[model samples]
Target: MYCPPAFREEELPALHDLMRAVRLANVVTSGTSGLHASPLPLFLDETDGPYGALYGHLARANEQWKDTPTGEALAIFMGSDAYVTPSWYASKKEHGKVVPTWNYTVVQARGPIEFFEDEGRLRGVVERLTSLHEAGRPEIWSVSDAPEKFIKGQLRGIVGLRLAITSLEGKRKMSQNRSAADRAGVAAGLSASARPGERLAAAEIPQG
Candidate 1:
């Protein structure tokens, strides 16, 4: 991901929090066929690795896993996003030079792609994914909620994936390049909008 200094996100804790809050991620890998991407719910295990590890699964027949990746694959986690209209900038009223843009947070994790179909590993992947999304619900679901035989049979139809993340890049573009008054305008404009993500982005404006 091409990131400029003004919009880059470099904090380790912040990056992990962004990834975890996003809930889902896009895994992209270049192959002989073409650039392929799979969007799936991901869970991270931050035990020992420098950047921890990523875990997820996809349909077994998804050819993304068929050919070994010749190099690093990228996993992208997208955070709160909002459209910033030109009217949100103070420059629009002064010099009238500003144009519409977008503000968002994103994290790109690149690493060696690893594939697994062993039942144990696959089972663990499925369980963690389920728990990550289902937690805090009134009636949380468990992997064991389904019949063991049924889950085993279901697991056979998909492939589990793990990436020992080697490089992690992130960016949070929330009108940081704009003047304080312009950014305040953006926050006020977005806060009044009904879009959930816009409201979220409205709160991320740095105190610059």
Candidate 2:
């Protein structure tokens, strides 16, 4: 994460919010074989540690777990990203120097990676994950809804992971480097775009 001072977000609450809101994250690790990446729905627990902890699970057959990592793992969470056209920049009119860029929020977490296959831990991770995603649904289905034997059997095919985040880098690139008129133009453009994600990002650009 190459972030300048103006674009850096040092607020833990904001980082945690981004993580939770973007439940789908990319977990990357480097092993003797090289870099390995997996997209997983990881949840952040901010109650402990200087940074926090991440929890998720992958299919037991995934070979990513077999490759031993030399150190901590990296997880990337992305939120509200949109493409910004130079046509929206006031600077473009002045000298045509502006270029296209992205406006978004991102968090990079590095932590000790621990993988487990214990039935209880796997069940706990999967249950909480299910509950978290299902919280807003009108009809809620729980782990107990299924027979114990069946649920236990299902857990055998998955592996759980816990990563204690040692370092967290957060960035919010919301046109902070652009002129006010340019930012306003971008906001107007994004606010009217067909994509809801662009509209959400439009609302985040600072008015200054």
Candidate 3:
């Protein structure tokens, strides 16, 4: 994440918010075979360590769990993102110097990756993940909803992951680099976009 000072977001609460809001993250690791990345729904336990710990599962057959990483693993989470057109900039009328860019919020977490197959730990992780995602549903579901034998059989097909976060990097580019008028134009353009993501991003940009 090449974040300029204006776009850097180092506050812990903000970083955690971004990670938690974006439950699905891309976990990347480098092994002897090269680099491998997997898109996984991860749960962040802020109280687990200084930075925090990430929990999730990988399919039992996933080679990513089998390969020992050469270094730390990286988990990337992305928030609302939108394309900004040069035509949305006020300066474009005076001088066509503006170019298209993307506005987005993202976080990168780096840590040592650990994979486990312990039934108890795997069960705990699965239960927690399910509850987290189903917290507000009208008909809540739980691991206990299934028969013990069936649940155990299902768990056998997966491997658990724990990444003790050592560091975190976060960035939010929301037209802050643009002039006030340009930013307002950007906000208007995004708010009128048909894409839901663009409308979400409009709220992040400043208004004149």
Backbone clash total for model 1 is: 0
Query: Please, what are the lDDT tens digits per residue for candidate 3 over residues 1-94?
Result: 7889999999999999999999689999988778889999999999999999999999999888888654699999999999999999999999
Residues 72-124 of candidate 2: C-alpha lDDT, one tens digit per residue: 89999988899999988878889998789998999999988989998888888
For each of the candidates, give the backbone clash count: 0, 0, 0
The local distance difference test score of each candidate is 0.89, 0.90, 0.94
Clashes of 3: 0
Off by over 4 Å in 1: none
**Candidate 1 lDDT over residue span 1-208, tens digit each:** 7899999888888888888888889999988888999998888888739998898999998999996565788999999999999987878889999888999999999998888899998998898888888888999999999998998899999998898888889999998898899999999999999988789899998756
State how far residue 125 of model 1 sits from its true place (Å): 1.0
Clashing pairs in 2: none
Q: Quote the lDDT for 169 in model 2.
A: 93
RMSD of each: 1.4, 1.4, 1.2
Predicted candidate 1, C-alpha RMSD: 1.4
Measured on C-alpha atoms, candidate 3 has an lDDT of 0.94
TM-score of each prediction: 0.95, 0.95, 0.96
| 10 residues in a row with least lDDT, candidate 3 | 62-71
